[model samples]
Target chain A: MKAACVENGLVLVRELPDPEPGKGQALVRTHSCGLCASDAHFISGGQNVIDLSRKMGGPYAALHYERAFVPGHEFVGEVLDYGPDSRRSVKTGRRVTSVPIMRQGGTHAVVGFSHECPGGCGELMLLDEDFLLEIPEGLPDDHAAMIEPLAVGLEHARRGRPEKGDAALVLGCGAIGLGVIAGLAMMGVGPIVAADFYADRRDLALKAGAHIAIDPRETDPYGPLPDFGGRRVNLIYENVGVPGMLQRIVEAAPFDGRIVMGGYCMEQEALFVFAAQNKRLNIQFAGGEEPQDMDLALRSIADGRLDVTPWLGGRVGLGGVADAIANLSGPGTPVRTVVDPRLL
Target chain B: MKAACVENGLVLVRELPDPEPGKGQALVRTHSCGLCASDAHFISGGQNVIDLSRKMGGPYAALHYERAFVPGHEFVGEVLDYGPDSRRSVKTGRRVTSVPIMRQGGTHAVVGFSHECPGGCGELMLLDEDFLLEIPEGLPDDHAAMIEPLAVGLEHARRGRPEKGDAALVLGCGAIGLGVIAGLAMMGVGPIVAADFYADRRDLALKAGAHIAIDPRETDPYGPLPDFGGRRVNLIYENVGVPGMLQRIVEAAPFDGRIVMGGYCMEQEALFVFAAQNKRLNIQFAGGEEPQDMDLALRSIADGRLDVTPWLGGRVGLGGVADAIANLSGPGTPVRTVVDPRLL
Candidate 1:
């Protein structure tokens, strides 16, 4: 099996023995896998200290990711075979997208992020039955590959609980931000304002149903921008995790505003506690989506309410995973670059 | 009539003209009014910059309260007489607890906080019909005086949405914290752990139905403390709005914990956003409670589900308002020091 593994802080395409599924698991042949910014973070060793500390359970300091781990979670694959002692019958050749967690020793461990478990970045991977969700027959493989990131966006929007005709602001134009914009659009939340440093991503945000896009470098994020004739933003989706953004969001939110924080920032940041208190803000810190979010994402996309076609930049192979990770951070990077294991 | 007003940063009791209620208003004779920390904050000139900026609509800076503002909101009173042309059939001499807002020039203004509207710190006050809630017959005057703060606690706990048998933590043992403890007890959330620097407040918290109380000064708030044989805390009511408490709360919260911050801190605080993200915390910043919360609070007290008897200290006259404000900040402060306008 051909696999893309993080070996000693380097992303390498290595040939490895095929992994067999355990009881109540299925062997999935990778079809289409999307490259996430977190994958780049893991590959480039820029995982946030606090997130790493909690995920890996160590001291409150920078965490060094252990070497030799497969790194792709957002993927659509087909089940090739079920493992021995499997009780239920899930048909072979069923296309699916799944949560990246595998049950290990009565605990859940992320598939690709954990070195012990191989993920769908490889030619063949194991999927636990509990975490697997069948991709609908009508949904294409490319759109199915987006269920994970789209689910993340849906989860953030769900937590924000936007009402119809509520003003919203997306503070990042990355793939996740684009997904959030799409989700907000589906919910009929209008006058969506998106801000990003990059023009390309901002343009993509417009296609994802943002009513207005702003370059924060040119205009003050808190200062006067396109208001869409609304009083203030009701919900703020902060996807760019860095110091000072939360304060900026606090300055822009109206009274009783909801802020869904999905960004992954490495550094400790100062919060405007007094200001947030006066505004009576509800700042929810969100991470990955639950299984239901993924299912809803797929359903929304299949129903034509969500479109990920604009977000798909191009597809690559296992050999190109290294370049994809590097270029995704560069200027004028594509919104999303997927990988096909067969191309290796 | 007599009133205690903030005159040149001093709480002074002075004779004033008895107010004549206007259309749709009722003249209420004050009975029992509780002294809140916010009253102290207003009297002692500790308004935060954000609150000040929004209130005054100017640059971000600490706001100074103008002299001659009354300082009380938590109060129970009796409707002495109706204003001219008032259509309300509400019985005269009926005891009630009303919202602390007065309609002035077609806009509602906080009664005690606004210099133009006199509050319950006076012998008699004019009440707006829209803001009045009749007190049930069985409830005592002292407990009815607590309806406002108790409502705030109910609002925070309502936002937290704790299930039955969830481990909870209340970080402050002040009036608001004690109210949250009472609310949580009414909700049947158990093994409630409360922390405070003062032993008296801790004892009061235990009386308020806290299963356990810890002195954070002696024991590390983040380290191992008495857990009452329960798992990590699922909900944290943060009434102590200091710099490091948020980080400590993040460290102690279980995954997907809900933190309701009802504290009012004037200082700029640093929040561990990344740590909160890793824990997927739902942090809700609460302000004053709504009318529904107040209604629920009164019902809870009337049904004997909540008790504010431990929170009430000895009553004081209007002449002692200054001393109560000063001593409330001192060591060995009473749980709650209420004022009886008739005592003047």
Candidate 2:
């Protein structure tokens, strides 16, 4: 099978042995996989992440930095075969998406980060049968692949506990931030404000249902909005994973604001506890998408309730993975670069 | 009127002019006031707090460092007189407690920390008539004074959102931590695990209905609890306000744990955003008690549902304020020192 493999800090397209389905696993052929910014971070500082995971005794402690791994968790695939003791809930040849977790004995491994479990960047991969969700008919593969990332925003929105009168402020205009804006808009939360450095990303935010989009350089996103009518921003979604961003949000957020930290900052961050405590802030650190979130996101996209066509950017093949990853690493206009493994 | 004044970082017992109540205010005679740890922190580093308030542009921005102010918010008092335009909700000479916030124009001031509003550390003080709650008959003054601190814990517990089978781990056994333990126990959240360095505080935790009170040095409070039946510590009340405590809790807590930050860490703190995001921890920083919390706390004590007699320790007068504050600043057996302004 052809795959884009991360080896020794470089992504190389090469021929690799096809993955076989294990117990409770189903072999799937990658239909479309989305490029993620986290993949760039992991490729650059894989060793540091592995060391931190080991020190924290987290689920990713088993990840080996030295080993080559394929990284693509946001994917849509078609089932080929099922392993022994499998539920085989979804029929073969049916398109599917999953929560990107493969259950191993007592613990579970994140499908993309683990060497043993190749991800959608490869032509073929193995997924846990229990986590598989059949894609509804008429939904394009690129849109089906987006369910994973969109689920993350939906989960953050659900965890944020948006009330009827909530004024939302979404930081950063990346795919995750756009998803958050979409989620907030879908839930009927009004007066959504979004901020980003790039003009293109800010445009994407507006298309994703943000009421106001600011460049952040010219305008302060945290400033009082005319639409809020003297009400403060009670719900904040943080998708910018930069250093000091958490502290900045803590300092700028109003009293009793709920901050959903959807950003994954790999570096150490400093905060003034007095600032957060004084404002009585609720800082919720959101994790990966859950099964239910994935289901809801796929349904929303399938029913045209969520228009993710604006987020779909350039499509790439296995050979173009390196360039796509590089384009995503720095500031660019592409919200998501889809990879079709079968493309030669 | 005699009062303990915080002037230029020194607490001095001084004779000040008798306060005259203005519109919507009531003149209250001090009955009992509790020496709080926050009061000590404010006295030691008031200038820094004031500077931070100014920078944050918070409600406390009006606090001035140069002006001498009375530092006691946790107090039980008697309504001596009411000014014009006041509702006079409580009868004259009736014992009462308030939320310790005085409405000034469009803004509000924390009663104890403001120069214009002297708190119960003085022989006489002014309280907002709208914020006062009449003390139930036969309730001791010292116990009534404890309502403010206990209400804080109750608020933390309510914000933490404990469920029927949720396990609570309280990180300290100070007045706030003990109140958390009491709140958790009263709400039937168990098995309540409390940690403290001092044996007396550990005893207080047990008396406050903690199922297990462990010295953190001897036993790891985050370790698997035999009483919890293999369930993780889902609800954690962090009353220990040390610098690295938030990061430590983020690293040690299980996935999907809710941590209520009740401790007021005066200094800046560092945290790893990845660590918190990976665990998906919810860090809720609780502020001072609200009016409903105060009412519920007073009712709990009045009905004998909550026994605060165990929390009361030494009794002090105007002259003893300095010593009581000092004792509270260091490690001691006294959970709360009650101050009676009438004492010579």
Candidate 3:
């Protein structure tokens, strides 16, 4: 089976032994796998993703994403075979995506970040049957690849609890930001304001349903009320985990606002605590989504309410993943770039 | 009538004409009034209480707190007379405490902060009958005066949603902090740890039901988990509102901790937002409480489950309020200073 393997600091496609299905697991043939920022983090040299995972001090502490680990978690695949003692949740050849949790020595290890099991960045991978969810009809392979990321957005939007007519500000135009916009749009939350540094990402945000997209370089988002059309932002989604973005959004929130933080900031960032205290805001941190959230994301995409194909910058095969990751790391890179393992 | 008035940055009891009950209002003889920090803010006069109120922008924007207004909001009194068109919620001579919102020419005004109606800092005060809550039989006068502040703590505790086995941390030992301790005690949340800069305040916190009281000046509160007895802090109540206090608490909190910010910080303060984001914390700011919360506070006090009498530093007459506020503002002062208008 062809898989993208990391050697030293570079990722390249190589023929690896096919992963076998363990108990309560199913063998899956990969369809489409999305390249994520975390994948870039693992591939880059300075900081090791496995060491950071251990530093987080969770079940991840014992788990390992070793030097040669496969890199993708957001991927769609088909059930190929079931292991002994499996529940047989789905038939062979069923189109599916799954929550990637592997039990290791009485603890759970996240699939893509675990060294014991290869992730969907390969032609063949093994997944827990209980974590599987069938992709619905009318959703393409590109959009199906987005089910995991979109579920992240849905979970964050659920945490914010945005109501109709409440003004919202999303302070990033990355993949997570686009997913949040799609979730908010499905919920009928209006007048969504989005901010981004890049014009292309800003356009993608608008396509995802942002009413107004501001390039922060040109305008002052923290100037005053008139900057946001005199409307008090009751809900804020901070997708930019940078230093000043959270502080700026907190300044624009009104009394009793809700701020959902979805961005993964690897470094410590400073914010004005007094500002958040004054508004009496509810600040919630969003990490990942539950199974129900994944179901909702798939349903919304199948119903045509969420269209993320525009977010897909390009498609590649396992052999092209390395270049795609390199290109995506540069400035003016596309929102999402995917790889199909079956392609030559 | 004797009333305490703020004139040119001084609060002294002065003889004034007896105030009469207006339409839909009642005249009450004050029993006990608590000296709050806002009173000090009003007397110091960098910004007047009304300006701050208006800046908050609610009913206070249209309501006026004239320069000579009396300053006490947490008080218990007996109804002396009823004005025309007053609803017969309680009879004359009924022991009650009101929420203190009075409509003045189509706009509502807060009682202690409103110039139009004298507060309980005086011998007599005008209260809207609609704002009144009858004191239960078993609750004493001093404890009844705490109903409002206790309600604040109850609201914050409710927002934090601490279960039975959850370890809690309180970051201040002020009057509000003691009230929060009492609320947490009533909810049966154990191993409550409290920190205070003042030794006297720490003593009061322990008396109020904190299992452990740490003087923050003697030890580094943010050092490591062993400093807090190697227990995870799942719930934190931030009542200090000072610079670096909230940040330290966020650092000490365990995974998915709930932090309730109850104190009001007047200036901007810096915090580590990444620490909070990584923990996936739910940070809620507690302001005013609901009617149900107020009822719960009173009920908790009436049933002898929550007692805050130890938090009272000392008692003073109307004329002594100025010196009391000044002394309480300084170090080595008691937690709460109450004023009994009947005393000389």
Candidate 4:
């Protein structure tokens, strides 16, 4: 099996030995895997300038606790084999997507994902039968690969409790930001304003059903996004954790507005506080996407409640690696990218 | 009548002509008045250091608009006379306490507190018919003088909705802090922990029904205050808007705890924002005592539900001019001070 491996400051496709199904586990043959900004955090000398202290919780327990570990958790695959004692929740050859979060760190999973002990991302993966949610009959592989991130957006939307007729502002049109916009749209929460600093991301936000795409680079988004609400936006889905970004969103929020912070903090430069005091805001944190949240996200996709297609800016295989990472990390990357591991 | 007027860095007890009742107003002969810390802001020139260009609304409005305006606004007095055409709502000769906050800048007020539309501290204050609350019989004039500042505590307690069985921390034992503790005690909110820099202030807070007095200058308060709630204080009545005081309260607050900012924000500070995020804090800016809120405070006092005796640290008069201001500004000046205009 060929998989993307991080070795000596490089993320390269390499042939790796296949893994076997353990107790309550299923062997999953990879189909597609998305390169997540989070994955960039785990790989030292890889790409992103991460602090290395705030590593995300995942299925690879020992590796998560170790110095060196394989990266990439956002992926889709077909169940190839399973322990005889595994539940009927999963079937061999069934296409599915699974969440990457783990309680004690993903030590049990190697390939696909596991709802059982914990899970991980590697050449060959072991998944607990319960973690796999079958992809709908006709959904494309690229769309299926997006389930994990969509769950993040879904969590924020659920926490925000956005109702129909509620205006929303999603700060940062990064991959997670796009998911928030799409999820909020599903609830009929609108006049949605998506804010970002990059032109390409702003354009992607519009395609993702944001009624207004505010590019801070061109105009002051602080005053513009809230004009639709007759005050500030009623709900702000904060997917960017820059210091001052929260204050801006707070000021741009209406009285008694709800702000769900769904971003992984750190890295952002500007910060402010007084703006929040003046608005009397209600803020809640929405951390890593849980499996149950991912389940609902997949269900929304299946029911057409959420439309993430517009945020799918590009698709690639392992061969198009550098461009995808660069685009995702550079000045302006579109909302999302789909990577097909099988194409390699 | 004599009023101590501050001019040219000099405070003098001058023979000022007695004020007369004007239309829609009443002349109140002051019996007792509380010297608030805000007066110290100007007396010590601590306020003269900053640029007032971006000052926010309220009592501070005059500081931005006019210079050397007459300052005292908190007092208990007998209504000497109601202006001609005084409505049935207000009767002359009724012993009452009035909050000095009135509308507009550079305008006349029914109360002699023309500084903030004429607060209640002058020898004879003309008050808007709207600002008066009937003082309860048998309540000491010194105690009645504090109802205005105490109303500050009552207003925040109302906004915080600190119910019975909730933990509360009254930070900064100014008149506002004593008021906060008293109000919380009436609401059955406890076990109240009072945090202040001064021993006298902290002791006064305890006497005002705070379960414990944690002086920050003597020891770290976080450990004990949080344990009072068996987790964290459910309500924090913040009367001191120091740079990091808000942050400390936020970090020590229980999940979803409420922080009612009972003090004034003379300037913007970064501490409020940083702690707000990590704690997911909710801060309500309780501006000065409102008319209705003042009534509630007086009623509470009349019913013996609140007490401010411990804060009435000293009593002086128009002639004790320099001493009154200095006492109110010091670290060991007891808690609250009262001024008798007759002393002039």
Candidate 5:
């Protein structure tokens, strides 16, 4: 069992041969993983149009260029064995925290996310023992390998149903825009801000709370915007899919605004549609992330209303998965780094 | 008080001197008016870049050539007079309706749509009677000249929340795309279809309740769309604003779809961001009309939900405003027609 592969434009640390679980599955084993800038934009063809209508076993994009597979899908695995009639009772090993949105021989899903269909990192992940969750003996396996990017910044702040104290923004500081400004400052929202043409992802989006951190190549993301005091963000979340970030978040929204998006840019460029129709904008996009946003994000990380430890920077070992893809293909690295896969 | 003036592109009727009401205002008097294609797209410059975000209004982009100014704004008037403490009142000749959203005495409220904002219309229409809406007396000045495209298809089916039986699609068969299939068939939505490239606006959108029209100059509006009875169109609406109809309503949506957009087109298009991120579209855009969507569209046309009499056809005064703007400027003029600005 060794794994960590990619091959051709290289990554490899391979081995293989290990299979087991069947009826309803549950094999698992990793215990740590998370690299995402969408796995360095799908190994750098800048997100080569994925959406194989959910094909499971393959180094997708037509055999990840003629073979070599395994890359990682955000994890914290454990199980080790299950199978037969499985209504879910993983036992051979226990201590879980999975999701790699399975398909490569099934289970431990949560890769790109799911409503009920995917997850399970690498080094073997056959989950379906009800998509395993278990991990709470006082949370820590590096915070369950950071609950899949804080469940993708709690599914992009649960699409602007934000209230209790609103104000947010977070354009693109990577790792899901600093996990959506640490899940909109743990759902209470605040001066948030975050943008990023990159000043080290705006100093790690001001240690993940972001009370300000601009730099759209230093100012002028269509002027103004960056305030916070007299709050005027009512949520924007867009993780830079850069089509001029949909006309700069509809010219930095506010008047009845919402946005959401969640990066993966390709281009269609501008769209003001009269400033998203005179600021009566809603613009949603990041859909599908259920289990009720991971059970209200593990009850907002056990009631501290989330913290995602300032986007935790370093943690390697899957034989440094090719030095975590050359420190996440440098743009000044450091955004969300974490991976163990039992140290390859 | 005469009016009818597009100058140089001719259509004269001149005179002038009447406009009174001031301070919060109210003068009204037009009584029935509807000649929009945004006034033949501002006498055919086709809403010239909404004259730079003024959401269209003004005598612009060259041609006004000397003596011109008095374009219409979609009327159905009456109040007849008021000036003091005027914040609106159902007095002196009552029956009202005005949305002429225009401001910028951008050179004397260019006459029609009774300039609701600018010096707010003249030869008399000072109205801000906090945006008037009383049209009731047995509804028919051709259904109060369809309260401005039925309050813009009731604000595009209330910003396309469309559900109670959705199967909409209504692209564009003029008169604001069959008044958005008569307000998505008064919200009981059904097999509505109605594409149009014009065979008399697809026979006036199959006489308005359009259960299928198509025609896109014979077909293929990015194919696949036709069937509404095996269910498809979970709402399209677009109202033909020309520049690639928001990329053919995102290559014909359906997978969590809803387009809406009211249309006016000018160049600024390209939107497929991964097929609107795997068909999760919402898109919306009405562009104007929101006084509680003309008071729930005059209480859904005084509660019978709505009926534009098979998209009316003819009825004029003010001396058939230049042969009703040359028979509603070509191809199929029977989609809607109304004018009696008190016969000028």
Candidate 6:
């Protein structure tokens, strides 16, 4: 199987043996996968992440820094075969997308991040049979691949717990931020304001249902919005993952503001606890996609209720994975750059 | 009126004019006031707090850095008189306690910190008539003075939202942390553990209803507890207001832990947002006492459901206010020092 593998902190295209399906696992032919910002972070700071996780006794302590792994979690594929003792609910050749977790006996590995389980960047991947969700008939493979990130947004929105008449401000307009905007918009949370440095991302934010899009350099995202009659932003979605961004948000958030942190900052950040305490702020650090969130995201996309077509950017093949990951951090980056294993 | 006032960044015992009752205000003769840690913070870094508040556009922007102010908020007093347009619900000479907020027309000031609103550290102070709660019969003046701090703990507990079978870890065993233990015990939350450097404070925590008290130097506060069948501490109350305590708590807290920050860290602090995000932690910055919390605290003391007599420490007069304030940050500090202006 040809794949883009992350080895020695560098991504390289190489031919690797096809992954065999274990018990309760199903083999799938890679259809399409999204190039995620997390993949970029893993490529740059995977060792640091592993070290920190080890220090904290977290789940990532099991990951070895020197091991090569395939990096793609937001993916959709067609089922090919199932291992023994699998549930086999979804028929072979059916398009499906799971939560990207593979259960192997007493332990589990996230399909994309572990060397034992290859991801959709490769020609073949394995998924937990019980966790698979069959893609609906009319849903495009690209959109199905997006369910993971959109599910992330749904989870973030749910964690934010937006109420009636609550104004939401998204701190970034990347794929995760746009998904948060779409989720907030779908949930009828209004007057959503999205901020980004690039004008193109800001435009994409507006297209993705942000009522207001502003370049943060020229405008304050936390300022009183005219759309809500000068109501301050009470709910903030922090998708900007930088060293000082959390502290900046804490200072800028209004009294009693609730913040949902969706961005994964691989570096250390600082916060002034006194300021947060004085404002009586509530901060919820949001995690990955859940089954219900994935279900809602897929249903929202399939029903045409969410127009994610604008979020889809240029497509790449296995060889372009490194460039796609690099492009994510550069100026005028697209909301999502997808990878199709056979594109080359 | 003779009072210990914060003047030019120094505590000076000087003769000052007695505070006059304004509209909807009641003049109260100082009975007893509990010296709080916040008073210590204010004395040392009042200017910095004011500057930060001004930068954040907080309510403290109106405070003047050079002005003399009284530093006491946890107080119980006897009503002397009521001003014009005051509610005057409580009869003259009745013992009372309020939420420490003095309403002046459209503007409001926290009683102890504002120069115009002298607090219970003075010979006489004024409080908003509407905010006063009558100290019940048989409640000692010292016990009544503690209602404010206990109310703070109740508010912190409410913000923590403890559930049945939840393990609670208090980071500091000061008066505020002891109050939290009492609040948790009163609410029937079980298996409370408190940590502090001072053995006396730890003993106070036990008296206030902590099931276990451990010296943080000898034992890890967040480690598995023996009482709850090795359940990890999922709920944390942070009362150690220091620069790096927040980050340390974030790192030590278990996955999906709920942290209620009752400590007011006046200094700028740093946090690793990635660590918090990876653990999916919820951090709630608890503010001061609310009316309902005050009522609960008063009722709990009056009914004998909560015993706070153990918290009352040495009593001081107006002349000793400076030493009492200085002692707060030193070793072997008492849970609380009471200031009785009439004693001298």
Question: Which candidate has the top score in DockQ?
Answer: 6
Quality of candidate 4's docking, in CAPRI categories?
A: incorrect
Candidate 6 lDDT tens digits, A52-84: 778887556677767777778999999999988
Interface Cα RMSD for all candidates? 3.2, 1.2, 4.5, 6.7, 10.4, 1.2
Give TM-score values for chain A, per-prediction: 0.87, 0.95, 0.87, 0.77, 0.34, 0.95
Q: Candidate 1 lDDT, tens digit per residue, B267-298?
A: 66776576777678888887668888888888
Across residues A1-344, which tens digit of lDDT does each residue of candidate 4 receive? 55555554456666665656666667777676666664553343222122221232123322332222345566677888887776757667788777653322333333322223222234456555667778877887667777888887777777677877677878888778888887777677768888887778887777767888877667655454444645346777877754466555654565556678776553432222333443445566564566777887788767776566765667776666546655566564545665666665
Q: Best to worst by lDDT, what's the order?
A: 2, 6, 1, 3, 4, 5
lDDT of 1 by residue, A126-216 (tens): 8888778988897878789888988888888777888875678899988789888988887889878888988888888898899888897
Each prediction's RMSD to truth: 6.1, 3.3, 7.5, 6.4, 18.5, 2.9
Model 2 steric clash pairs = none
| Model 2, span A147-203: residue lDDT tens | 999998888877787889889999988888988988898888988998898888888
> Per-prediction TM-score, please?
0.73, 0.89, 0.67, 0.73, 0.38, 0.91
Judging by DockQ, tell me the better candidate of 2 and 6: 6
lDDT of each: 0.77, 0.85, 0.75, 0.63, 0.62, 0.85
lDDT of 2: 0.85
Alpha carbon lDDT at B197, candidate 1: 86
By DockQ, is 1 or 2 better?
2
What TM-score would chain B receive for each of the candidates shown? 0.86, 0.95, 0.85, 0.82, 0.34, 0.96
B1-344, model 4: which lDDT tens digit per residue?
56776554456566556666656677777788777776654454424322231232222323532243345767888888877887736567778777674434453232332433334445777777666788878888887887788887777777776776677777888878888787777777768888887778777888778888887777555454544534456677878754455555655665457777766554444432322433445566564566877887777777776656666678887777567776565576756777887665
User: Looking at candidate 2, what is the lDDT of residue A154?
Assistant: 85
The deviation in Å at residue A206 for candidate 6 is 4.2
